[model samples]
Target: MKKRFVVLVIAAFMLFVFGSMAEATVANKQIQVNYNNVKIVTNGKAVTLTADQEPFLLNGVTFVPLRAAGQALNSTVNWEASTKTVVITGNSNNNASNTDLLVQIAQKNQEIVALKAQVAALQAKLDDEDTDEDYDLDKIEDKLLDQYGELEDVKIDEIALKGDDDFVKVDVEVDLDDYKKEWKDLTEREIKNWVEDLVEEIQAKLNSNTVVDGMIYSTDDEDLVEFYKRGKNRLDVYIINNYKGVNASKVIDSLEGDRYSVEGIRFSIGELDYEEDKELVNVNFEAEAADVAERWDELNRIEISDAVDKIGKAIAGEFENEDVPVEAVRLYFYDEDNERLGSYRYNNN
Candidate 1:
């Protein structure tokens, strides 16, 4: 009988392992129990149980096969034929402290809720920062116009501001008639001084309102129009559009006294070199012999080096910020026929 019972258990185990094994049904007066599909998990991975050993739920109670429950709980399982009952024996630690597990699960749920709340608070803070950093173009333009409008003889037509850093780029448009009217009577030296003062004032005001690193001011008449740039080590200006250098000649002429003058001397920037370590400027001029020859002897004998240095410095001073130091000047003088009369190069060093 013991051997027969052992054989029955082995046969049942084989039937589970190889599901194609036929099942035996014997007529008995035992209560019928139905099984339904229910999943079992151990250490987070799914465990597939055969139909005979699978767990099921009925009448709000879960019923698991003896062997399946023993394996899941890591316990030893034994069957008793006298009472037809199965017993599971586990170590002291695995004696099924379900109440402690419930407490642990509740604590874990509370921790998850707290983590979700923290994430939501951080997201809200980020949203508030984004709102505070928004830019208002209309307000910026209004403030700019208000400050510049107070300057005499400057008719502000347009103002544009870009970027939100220590370096703000600005572009402005205005009418030049008023500015010319203010400077029309000033001598060349006085004009330069006035422009320098004006530039400082404008730069300060703009910087105070917002950090300004570069600016371009344009005029309808183009007089006193300035393109201003400030860099770590250099500042510069270029006369654009007038190939004959008419505007440049006028500016140079303004610097002359009664003894000698560069008036009516049409000139252009023949070459400009602005490499990383070298900065050079070259100017070419054409004038009537009568005008140039009036100081011919004096011109040749004059301090050419001093004259070039003064011219270079004056040109550099026009812009508010200078990054590169002007190092040299090359002058090419021509007569009425555009024939080169003389050429000279001066180095600051």
Candidate 2:
């Protein structure tokens, strides 16, 4: 009983001394003096605190580095040297392990920057490829000149390429005077065959040209081919074999015009007569003008003439004359009654 009472008195005396020391430190300079009995533990494991950050006891008061203490307690630690302050934070409860996590974050940012640079470089390469694919007449013209440089019978005056990713249109002008000298009396059919052969050669060379992505251009693509004379020269170097991809059936489908009679007369084109020998296309159609049969001559001369001209222009895009002049658009007109009216011809001669 005496021993227990003595032990309680020693414990009360120690508590009172420690409390007074804490109050003094808070009120005074808060400086700590060295005491060799400090220890640190983290997550149930003993941690060896750094020498500079070792805890100490000053006049019976304990002191520790804010960083070391925060880490030991699993709390984030930040020191403000300017204000001489320490801040600690955590998710669920303030926590921290070591400086390794900060290093990881920095490395991740660098990787992201590198990836962005790689993507930008790939995009630049693709843009360059597209530019090469776009048509450039200078390159094509150079190729043509190189191929025909030694030929005395051919002179390429101009070359042009146009169109988009869907297709490419090429136009080449050649001086055929030398060609004519060789075949002065050649039939039109023979001349047309010769021109086609020339086109094939040019098309093949263009497909294999090195200026762009080779093998991307083709002449077999429908509606992607055309031939035209050079500007202002008008000496008909080449011809569009299938202009606008229009034909006799397409022209017949495109005819539409009113005769302006009492019954609102309309014109309808029928069978197309191709006079290859004379270079003419005879358009035969019946005009529904039953209300004004007596005025057939006047109507045939004026109304029919104007109608034929308009119709010819509309269907002219379908012709494949290949530099051969179309002498005229011969209109063989008949009334709804099947009576043959006088024919009227139209031409841009």
Candidate 3:
């Protein structure tokens, strides 16, 4: 009878120990959950839960606990429960923080909204201008052919005309051979100008009765040339078309100044008069070496000129092929005092 009691006591003790071990294992195990396409894992493994997955709304801000999500992504996390936000800082260099991610998402949304607004505004403006009645299709075609010689052989594939509307959509199909034959002689700049002029003329003809507010978008090669021709006394004036409310005189005045070259300062003038009763107007000018060095010291901060010279030397050394000649180097200095420090160019030849 005593032996039977001992066996019963031992069995009871064994069961109790096993039960405690099972409970400890359950407590130590990790839980996993998924929310808003982001995987959240607790500890090393995924947590399985049947809770309705919704964005955690706390204090008017949406947040997810970083500790729950970071382990799955192999990242570090810190939770500020007081602020109801979890900051999941990634261990990897490419990993972005939750705050940065949110900001980026917000910026993308703003850009989309802005683009939609712009499109709506443009559509409304087009609709208002469409009230004009008179539009001569043949005249438009003739003008296009005259301006763009390549378009002369182009066949009008489709023409969609709306009744009493100023604007008509015309799609043209051109023969590649004819286009190449005619347009090959024209420079890229000339081609761009031709297109812009044609568009402006067509718009004007279409909206004869309505006041149309539109701008021509084209590449200005002349502006690029002006930008490159530093330290010249004369500027080659090329105005494609006169734009209303734009101050052309002010722009011309701004360009008239002393330009810098690597060797010296070059003076530029809007207009010049020489001997034999000949007047040179809008000329780009170049200065002597002595003048440039003197101006560099006076006008520019010492470090800027040195930095520019170093860069120029590096460039010259890199492309030291016999066919390529390093002609000149120029630097434009715009410091706190002088905002319009003219561009300087260096010429070896």
Candidate 1: lDDT of 299? 54
Worst 10 residues of 2 by lDDT: 1-10
In the range 1-349, model 2's lDDT, one tens digit per residue, is: 1111101112234345444644653343545476574666555566566768666656654455556655655566776778545556654532243466777889999999999999999999997875674345567557655664322333445445564333345554444444434322333333334444444444454442321211111133222123332222221222223222222322322332323221245556654544445667677667654744565644535555676677665454446433434567776666777776656576746
Q: Please provide, for model 1 over 1-349, each residue's C-alpha lDDT reduced to its tens digit, 9 standing for 90 to 100.
A: 1111111122244235324312443355544454545666656655557857755444544455657645665766777768554555665665457768988999999999999999999999997765444344455567666655533443667667676534556566555455545433323333334334433444443443444443334465353434444523222332332212223423333223212224333444433332223345455655534555445435544555556555555554432134435466556666656667677666656
The C-alpha stretches of model 2 lying farther than 4 A from their native spots are 1-264, 295-304, 320-325
RMSD of each: 19.8, 19.0, 24.6
Ranking by TM-score: 1, 2, 3
**Clashing residue pairs for model 1:** 233-323, 234-322, 234-323, 234-324, 235-322, 235-323, 235-324
lDDT of each: 0.49, 0.48, 0.39
Model 1 worst lDDT window (10 residues)? 1-10
Clash pairs of candidate 2?
74-95, 74-96, 75-94, 75-95, 75-96, 76-95, 90-94
lDDT of 3 by residue, 124-239 (tens): 88866653322545655666555554433333222222222233443333333333344333332343344445445555656533222222211331111111011122213332
Per-residue lDDT for 131 in model 1?
A: 46
What TM value does model 1 have? Answer: 0.25
lDDT score, candidate 3, position 262:
40
Candidate 3 has a TM-score of 0.24
